[model samples]
Target: MNSPSLVATASITSPHRVGCQAGVQIGQACWELYCLEHGIYPDGVPYNDYGDGNLDPFFSETKEGRYVPRTLFVDLEPSVVDEVRHGVYRDLFRPDDLVTHTEDAANNFARGRYSVGQEVVRKVLNRIRKQAEACSGLQGFMFFHSFGGGTGSGFMSLLLEKVMEEFTSPSMLRFAVFPSPRMSTAVVEPYNAVLHASTTMEYDHCVFVFDNEATYNLCINKLHRAIAAIRVKKTVQFVEWCPTGFKLGINSGPPTVVPGGDLAKTNRAVCMLANTTAFREAWARVNLKFDLMYSKRAFVHWYAGEGLEEAELSEARENMAQLERDYEEVDGHDDDLMDNHEF
Candidate 1:
């Protein structure tokens, strides 16, 4: 048989309780959906004698014939990890794969990137390396993280840098939860978000940005599910160079709602995979906010004390400004270039 194309997923959460809870909820929902789709039980055993779909991408079979998900849950704090350890799907993960640290990043990017995060990064990397070594044909990595929190933004950025250095061939895709000021959790969110984006721009192959405000608005309006994809695509703009930026799929079956979750039952679901330039607008907004706070040197000492230099902040701002321009450039067609010309 040909080598299985394996893809690993890593869910990195911030130290904050809210961020950790959200990460775990999403991870649980994903595990539940995968189990249902592959006809696997919560304990990782086959549901029936009929083996139907391919599970190689997301699962690895053990010597005892149990299939465990190829996923990792990471955080700088252990409370959320402990919860998952005792949760309903506890049997679905290996103990070593769920990595955590005793101390937290304390909502500071510099602390996560340079100080406390460094203490646990090696352990996290070793776990990732172990996962990669098991695959015969490893395809890529999928990261789920929040953009506005310390561990999610700063520690994740540090991890991305290390991953790029260690595994150069595998593509990296991110599912980033963008921050909304209306539902902001911390005063330094803008700083974390901007710095995270600027640092990881080159590391990520593609990113799917999720907005809590948009989701909250959708729920409040009780909008039709069928038109949601269309509305979202209409609002976002993609680059002209990439024609297949948006891919939409309709699943006949309804989404698998998590137990005790607030999501309503629905008949159908629309999933949209996108690579758009619209995220540059979010970067722009955060950068503007960062500048407003940074002009007065507010909260600079916290990061500086944690080993972050003032020059790096200036460089990050410049990097984001250039990134915005790069997006704008890609969105427009180049009239000077002839399609028929050959290199």
Candidate 2:
């Protein structure tokens, strides 16, 4: 019952990369959990405090799995690479994981830079393909992106098409969040979003949608009702299994949820909520602010502009409330549909 490994890829330009940051957190958490599970005590703490962690990267293997950890980083900005390589998350990501495919996309839209984005992704995908060739039982893929920008939307959609085209059998899930309309992004976000919508619908087995506005409101006005604790039985698993990379699989757990840092904590929480019977009650404590750290925006003028009035903002709040209701209903329906079939 060992779950397949996950390959979490995010464009440097998009905020969705925040979710991909879990590689660091999960690795640490898993080490701690492993030490606690095993009889190891270093300075009275259960973690990788005892060994160099190089001779053996993993501490345990059971029905849950002990995947060999490796990452492939993809982005178009050299400056972004500098930040990641020399920044706070250096410990979470390895030097080899950074692909160094630089493409300037600050002032462009998805539709504007479609070709160049594809070229950059081609290089990164080649690297992922190499991983697929080398690794055994490498399950499916989980793509993280926001639909409101050029790289995340345009590049993400293209990557999905290519992934689906090359590896037809593996399942793909898109973890998508919306860009703020009046908050602080390009007005063309609407355009990038609409362009990405068709491709996303075409490729993804499931598109888990979240909105900045709704999450913000939940943390603000509904902190008491944020996403609650998840309830899963020992044998249950949410994601499927596949033989190919960038494809679908119903037999394995999502790699994003297992841990290291990008969205390790949040995805773990999400997987919990995704399986439980109490949808609304379980949706009681999802930390929006914590996840917001990955949401980097170059557009600050939107906040200063008068183009988005208070009336629009009020309506936006209402939309978010309605969206949550829709999510609860859909999530439950999805569970039922999946339960009827086992692949």
Candidate 2 lDDT tens digits, 60-173: 222433223344555555555555567544544446667655454442444324555756766777866766665456567766556666666666667777777777577766
Candidates' C-alpha lDDT: 0.74, 0.47
lDDT computed for candidate 2: 0.47
- C-alpha lDDT of residue 90 in model 2: 54
Question: RMSD in Å for candidate 1, one decimal?
Answer: 6.4
- For model 1, residues 308-327, the per-residue Cα lDDT tens digits are 99898888888888998886
* Cα lDDT, model 1, residue 200: 86
Reference-based lDDT, residue 187, model 1: 81
The TM-scores, one per candidate, come to 0.83, 0.52
Candidate 1 TM-score to native: 0.83
Off by over 4 Å in 2: 12-68, 88-94, 110-113, 222-343
